[model samples]
Target chain A: MNNERILLVSRPKGTPAMSDFRYEEAAVPELKGDQVLVKTIYLSVDPYMRGRMNDTKSYVPPFELNEVISGGIVGQVVQSLSSDLAEGDFVIGNLPWQKYNVVNDISVRKLDSNIAPLSANLGVLGMTGLTAYFGLLDIGKPQEGETVVVSGAAGAVGTIVGQIAKIKGARVVGIAGSEEKTAYLKNELGFDEVINYKTDNVFEALKAACPGGVDVYFDNVGGEISDAVLRLLNHGARIPVCGQIALYNLEKMDVGPRIQSQLLINSALMKGFIVSDYAAHFEEGAMELAKWLMEGKLSYKENIVEGFENTIDAFLGLFKGENTGKQLVKVAEPENV
Target chain B: MNNERILLVSRPKGTPAMSDFRYEEAAVPELKGDQVLVKTIYLSVDPYMRGRMNDTKSYVPPFELNEVISGGIVGQVVQSLSSDLAEGDFVIGNLPWQKYNVVNDISVRKLDSNIAPLSANLGVLGMTGLTAYFGLLDIGKPQEGETVVVSGAAGAVGTIVGQIAKIKGARVVGIAGSEEKTAYLKNELGFDEVINYKTDNVFEALKAACPGGVDVYFDNVGGEISDAVLRLLNHGARIPVCGQIALYNLEKMDVGPRIQSQLLINSALMKGFIVSDYAAHFEEGAMELAKWLMEGKLSYKENIVEGFENTIDAFLGLFKGENTGKQLVKVAEPENV
Candidate 1:
C-alpha cells in the first residue's frame, strides 16, 4: 500500500506558506517485531508547532529540513506484532504526518472508542484538555469569588479553562477575536463576561468587565492583550503563561513595556509551563477532566477538515484564526469498524 | 526641647533633590498617657523610599506633602508614661525623620543591646535582614548545588541574600555596579562569583560565572540587568522580585523585550514580593537569621553617615550608589551607655 506523507521543505521567515511543505508518496513497509501498522484517523495542528519550524533552541527541537513533520495523531491499528496483538483497535500516538504509520507499540496508547468519540483523543480527552486542566488549576488557582481573565477564550484550552473557572465559582471573563466566540463563551459556557478583541477596545472593555481587578489570568494569546490585562492586576495576582500565539510568526523578538515594577508593586506572580511537566499527574488530571465531561460540566468544540491532502492547509489555518476551536485533519475512517 | 525634623517640601519629578526637603525646628510635645518619648539615634534610608516620594499609588501610600518623612528608625526611650517601658531602654519604631518622637507604647519594640549593636536592629537583624530571609528562601527557593544570582549584591538585602544562598549549598553570583562592591561580595560575603556590571560585560560575565545557568535570581536592581539574567535561566528557574532600584528614578515608563516567551520555554516562575507579605512568620524568620548571625555563619555591613544634618544626603545618596551596604544617618548617641 502507498503511505503518503507531508515533509517540511523549507523554514518560514514569518508566516508559513504552502511551498514550505512538500507532499510525498512512499511504499508502506512490512511491520517488524514489536511494531504496529496503523492507519491515521485524525491529526492535531497547534500554535506551538510554529516554534518547531524554526532552527532555534526551544523546549522542543526545530523540525529538520526535508523531514516529515510529526505531532499528535489518533489512528486505528491495522496490524500488530508481539503479545499485545490487535488487528483492529483505536490508538493515539505522536506520529508523522502520514496516512499510515509503522511505529513501535510502546509509542501508542490503545484507546477505547466506547468511552468517548475517537477524535476526542486528539483534543479534549487529550493534550489540549490536559494543558488547560493543569495550567489553570495548579498555576492559575482561582479561588471562589476571585476574577479570572482568559485570553483566546473560544479555542480548545481557553474554552475548557473558562468552564472550569465557572465551576470553581469565580467570575470568568473571556477575550477572543470574534463576536461569535464571545457569544458562545457567555451564552453557552456560562462565562460572566466576554470581550471581543477585534471589535472593542480591549483595555477599556476589560477594565469595565473586571471591576474588582483580575486575580487570576490564564494567558493564551500574549501581546497587547496581555499588556492590557496586566495593568489591572490586584495584589497577589497570578498569571499562568500558556501560549503566545500572537508572536508566533514575528521575524524579530517581541518588545513591550517591562513589567518588573508592576509585579513588584502588586506582589504578583507570573509562571510558564508545558503540559508534559505534569506527566506524573496525567492519570489524575485525565480522570477529573473525563468526569467533568460525563457530568455535563464541560463542553468542547472541534474544527476538523476532511482529507489528508488538506493537512498542510489545516495546519496553516491556525495562524490566521480560521478555526474556532481545536483544529484537526481527518485522514481516514476505521475500515474494520 | 527642640524637635528638629525633615519634611517633604515638594514631590520629586524623577530623582529627589535636597531642595525637595525642608529642615525645621519644632517644639517637642509633652508625653501623654500611654505615650513614650523616643530620641532618634539611627535612621534607615532605603531604595523603596523612592516610590513613597512619588504622588502615586504604590505598595505604601505616598508621603503627604509638607509632612515628616517617616521610616524605619531606632531610638532611645528617653521618657515613658506607660508601665510597659522605662527610660534608658533602646527601641525600634517607624517614626518621623526627627530628633525626637512622641509615640505610643505599642508602636515600638524594646531591643536588647547585648544581642548585637543597637544599629543592627535597623539593618541586619531588622527589616532588611527579614526581607532577604523571606524573599530568598520563600520565593527564590534555591536548592543545593543550584546557581543563585543576586543583583545589588552590596546592598543590605542583597548581601544577606547571597550569604543565605551560600548556606543552602548553592553557587552564588553577585552583580553590582563597581569593582569595589563586587570585591566585597566575593571576599567579604563569600559569594562564589561576582560581576561588576559597570566595568565588565554583565551578560557575558554572568554567563561565565553561572556555568550551570541561573536557578534562583534575587532581583534588587531591575532593568537591562534583569533582562541579561532572564536570558540565561535554566528549566524551572525561580526569580524573586525584591526591588527595582534601577527604574525607581525613571520619569517615564520602562520599555524592554518582553519575557513571557523566555519563561514559557523554560517553565520558569517569577514572583514579586514585599517582606511584610510573610508577616505571619516574622518571628520564625528573625529567629533563623539571628541564629545564623550568632553562629558566625552570617556577617553584615553598614555605611553610616554621622549627624542628623546629613540625613537627606544619605537618603539621596542611595540613587547614586554612594553607600555599599545599609545606608544610615546617626542622629544621636545613647547617653546612658
Candidate 2:
C-alpha cells in the first residue's frame, strides 16, 4: 500500500510560501515486534511549528531540510503485533504528518472515546487544552475579580485560556483580529470585554476595558498587542507567554519599547513557558480540565480542514489569523470504527 | 537654629542638571510630643532616586516640584521629647535631604551602630543588602554550580548580589563599565569572570565567560548591556531586575529587541522589584545578610563625599558611574557620639 507525507522542502524566508513544502508518496513499511499499523485520522497544526521551521535555536529543534514534519496526531489501531494494543483502539501521539504510521505500540497512548470525542483528544483534552490549563493556572494565576487579558483570544490556546480565566472568576478581556472573534469571546465565552485589534486602538481600548488594570496577561500573540496589555498591568501583575505568533514569520529581530522599565515600575512578572514544563503534573491538570468540561464550566472550538493535502494551508493560515480555534487537518476515517 | 535642605526646584526633562535643585534655609522647628530632632549624618544617594526626579509615575511617587527630596538617611537623635527614643540613638529613615529633620520617633528605625558602621545602615546590611538578598534568593534563586550574571556589578546592589550568588556556590560573572570596577569584582570579590562593558565586546566576553549559559541575571543596569546578557540565558533562567540606571536618564523612550521571544524559547522568567516589595520579610532578609557579613562571607564599600553641599553632586555622580559602590553624602558629625 502507499503512504502520503509532507516534507519541508526549503527553509522559509520572511513568510512561508507553498514552494517551501512538498508532498511525497512511499510504500507503507511492515510492522515489527510490538508495533502497530495506525491510520492517521487527524493532525494538529500549531503556531509554535513556525519556530521549528527556521534554522535557529528554540525550545524545540528546527526541522531539518526535506524531513517529515511531526506533530500531534490522532489515529486508530488498524493492525497490532502485540497484546498491548488491538485493532480498533483509538490512540494519540506525536506522529509524523502522514496518512499512516507503523510504530511501536508504546509510542502512542490509547484514548477512551467514551469520555470525549476522538478529535477532542487532539485538542481540548490534548496539547492545546493542557497548554491553556498550565499556562493560565500556573503562570497567570488569575485571582478572583482580578482582570485577565489574553491576546490571540480566538485561537486554540487563547480561547481556552479566556474560558479558564473566567472559570477562575477573573474579569476576562480578550484581544483578537476580527469582529466575529470578539463577539464569540464576549457573547459566547463570557468574556467581560473583547477588543478587535484590527479596528480599535489596542492600548486605548485595553485601558478603557480594564478599568482596574490588567493583573494577568495570557500572551499568545506577542508584539504590539502584548505591548498594549503590558502598559495596563497593575502592581504585581503576571504575564504568561505561551506563543509569539505575531513575530513568528518575521525575517528580522522584532523590536519595540523595552519592557523591563514597565515591569520595574509595576513590580510585575513575565514568564515564558511550554506545556511540557508541567509534564509531571499533566494528569492532575488534565483531570481538572476534564472535570471542568464535564461540568460545562469549559468549552472549546475546532476549525478542522478536510484532506491531508490541505495541511500546509492549515498551518500557514495561522499567521493570517484565519482559524478561530484549534486548526486541525482530517486525513482519513477510522477504518475499524 | 537654621537647617539647610535641598529641594527639587524643577522637574528634569531628561538627565537631571544641578540647576534642577535649589538649596534653602529654614528655622528649626521645636520638638513636639513624640517628636525627635534628627541630625542627618550619612545620607544615601542611589540610582533609583533618578526615577523620582521625573514627573512620570514610578514604583515610588515622583518628587513634587519645589519639595524636599527624601531617601534613605542615617541620622543621630540630637533632641527628643519622645520616651521611645533617647538622645544619641542612631536611626535610619526615609528622611529629607537636609542638615536636620524634626520628626516623630516612630518614623525612624533605631540602628545598632556597634553591629556595623552607622553608614552601613544605608548600604550593605540595610537597603542594598536586603535588595540583593530577596532579589537573588527569592527571584534569581541561583543554585549551586549555576552561572549568575550581574550587570552594574560594581554598584551597591550589584556588588552585594554577586557576593550572595557566590555564597550560594554559583559561578558569578560581573559586568561593569570601568576596568577598575571589574578588577575590584574579580580580584577582591572573587567573581569568576568580570567584563568591562565599555572596553570589551560584551556579547563576546559574556559568551567566553559563561560557557554553560546564564542561569540567573541580576539586572541592575538595563539597556544594551541587559540585552546582551539576555541572549545568553539558559532554559528556565531567572532575571531579577533591580534597577535600570542605564536608561533612567534617556530623554525619549528606550527601544530594543523585544525580549519575549528569548524568554519564550528558553522558558525563562524576568521579574522587576523594589526592596520595599519584600518589606513583610525585611527582618528575615536583613538578619541573613547580617549573619553573612559577620561570617566574612560578605563585604561592602561606600564612596562617601564629605559635606551636605555635595549631596546633589554625589547623586549626579551616579549617572556618570563615578562611584564604585554605595554613594553617600556625609552631612555632619554625631554631636552626642
Candidate 3:
C-alpha cells in the first residue's frame, strides 16, 4: 500500500511554521518476522512533539530532517506476523505521522475504546491522564482544603489536574488564556477560581483567589506567569513540572525570575515527569480515569483536525495556543468492533 | 551563674557583619516545668542562620533585632525538672548562643555518639546526616553506577551526600570553591572527582567530569553553578535541594534562568527539604549513617572556632568559603560527657 506521511522539512529555529513540513506519499513496506501493518486512524499532537522538532538530546530523539514525525497514534492492525497481535485488532502505540504504519506487533497494546472514545487514548485516558494523575497525586500531593493552582488549567493535562485536585478535596484555581476557557473551568470544570492570564494581572488575581498560599502547583505552562505564582507559595508547597508550553516558541529560553532561593525559603518540591515514569501505575490510573469519565465526574475535550495532511498544522497550533484540549488528527474512519 | 550570650544587635541590610551581633553576660534562667537547663557546649553556625538573622520569612522564622540567635547545638543537661531527661545527659537540640538554655526536655534528643565524636550529632549523626541520607535516597534516588554531583562538596551536608551516593554505588563528583576543599573531596573523601569553582569554568569542568550526564544532583549551593549543572542533567535526573548557601547574603535575590523547562525536558525532580521532614525516618537514617561511619566508609571534618565571641566570625567564614566541613563555635568548657 502507498503510505502518505508528513516529513519535517527543517528543524525549527523558533515556533515551527507550516513551511517546515512537507507531505509525501511512499510505498508501505511488507511485514517483517514480527512486523504488523497498521492503518492509522488518529495521530496525537502533544507539547512534547515541539521538542522533537529541535535537534537536541532529550527524553526522545529529535525528529530527523525529511523523516515522518513520530507521536502517539491509535491504529487498526491489518496484517501481523507476531503471535502477540493479529489482523483486525485496534491497538494504541507510538506511530509516525502517516496514513499507514509498518510497526512491530509486539510494541502495540490492543485498545478497547468501547469503554469510551478511542481518541481518549491520546488525551484524558492516555498520556495526558497519566501525566495529570501522577503529577497531581505524586508530585503535588494535594491535601484536603489546600489551595491547588494549575497553569494551562483549561488545556488537556491541566484541565484534568484541576478536577482531580477537586476530587481530592483541594480548592482548585485555574489560570488560562481565554475568557471562555476560564468560564468552562469555573462553571463546568468545578475550578473554585479561574484567572484569565491573557487579560488579568495573574499574580494579583491568583493572590486574591488563593488568600491562602499555593500548596500544590501543577504547572503546565512555565514562563513569567509561573514566577507570579511562585511568590504566593506557602511553606512546604509542591510543584509538579509537567509541560512548559510557554517556551516552545523560544530559540533561547528566557531567564525569568530566579526561583531557587524562593523555592528554598518555601521548601517546595518541584519535580518533572513524563507519563512513562508511572507506567507501573498506568493500569490503575487508566482504570480510575475511565471511571471518572463514565460517571461524569470529569470532562475532556478533543479538537480534531480532519485528514493526515493537517497533522503538522494541528501540531503547530499547540504552540500558538489555538487548540482547546487534546489536539489530534484523524487519518481514517474506524471500522466497527 | 553568669551566662554570656550573643545577640543580634541590628538587622543586616544584605551581608551580615560582626557589628550586627553583640556579646553580653546575663543570668542563666532557672529550670521550670518540663524544662531541662542545658549548658551550651558546642554552638553550630550554619548558613540558614543568616536567613534567620534577616527580617524575612523563610523555612524558619527570622531572628529579631536584639534577640539571642538560636540554632542546632549539642549541649549537656546541667539540671533537670523533667523525668524524661537527667542531669549531665549529653543532649542535642536547638540552643541559642547563650551559655545556658532552659528548654523543654521533649525538645532535645539524647545523643550517645559512642563510636564517633559527640560533635558528630551537630552534623553527620543528627540533622545534616538525616538531610543528606533522606534527601538523596528519598528524593535524589541514585542508581548504581549513575553519576551524582554535589555543590558545596566539602561542607557537612555535601560530604555526607557524596559519601552516601558512593555507598549507593554511584559515581560521585564534588564542587567546592577552594582548591584545598576540592582536594579534600577527591583525596580524603574518595569522591570520583572534584572541581574548584573559583578557578575552573564549572560548565566546562562539569562536561569533563561527567562524560555521562549527571544522573543525580545534590544542590547545596544554588546559583549560576546550579544553572550550569542543570544543562548537564541526564534524562530523569533527580535533584535533592538540601541547602542554598549562595543566596543567603543577597539583600535582594536575583533570579536565574527559568529551570522548570529544563526540569520538564529532562524529567528531573527538584525538591527542597529540611532534615526534619524525615523525623520519622530518624532512627533508620541515624542507624544507617552510624553504620557507615563505624565502617570508616564515611569521613567528616569540623571547622571549630574556640570561644562563643567568635560566632559571627565563624558564620561569615561560610560566605567566604573558609570552613572545611561543619562550621561551629565552642561557647565554654565542656561538660565532659
TM-score per candidate, chains pooled: 0.99, 0.99, 0.92
Write one digit per residue (lDDT tens) for candidate 1, span A1-337. Answer: 9999999999999999999999999999998979999899999998899889999877788999999999999998888894574878888999999999998899898998887889888788899999998999999999999999999889888999998898898999999988788888999889999999998999999999999999999999889999999999999999999999998899998999988888888999999999999999999999888899999998888999999999988988887777877899999988864
Q: Which candidate leads in lDDT? A: 2
DockQ of each: 0.86, 0.93, 0.62
- Of the pair 2 and 3, which is ahead by DockQ? 2
Candidate that would win on TM-score: 2
lDDT of 1: 0.92
Best by DockQ: 2
The list of candidate 2 runs beyond 4 A from truth reads none
CA-lDDT, candidates in order: 0.92, 0.93, 0.87
Summarize candidate 3's per-residue lDDT along A264-329 as a digit string, tens digits.
777788888888888898999989999998999889888999988778778888877777777888
Residue A139: error of model 1 in Å?
0.8
Error of 2 at A4 (Å): 0.3
Q: Which of the predicted structures, 1 or 3, would earn the higher TM-score when compared with the native?
A: 1
What does candidate 3's lDDT look like per residue over B119-218, in tens digits?
8888888788888899899989999999999999988889999999999999999999898898888889899999999999999999999999999999
Model 3 CA deviation exceeding 4 Å by range: A1-3, A27-38, A75-91, A102-110, A334-337, B29-37, B76-90, B102-116, B335-337
Ten residues in sequence with the least summed lDDT for candidate 3 chain B: B328-337
TM-score of chain A of each: 0.98, 0.99, 0.96
Q: How far off is residue A207 in model 3, in Å?
A: 1.5
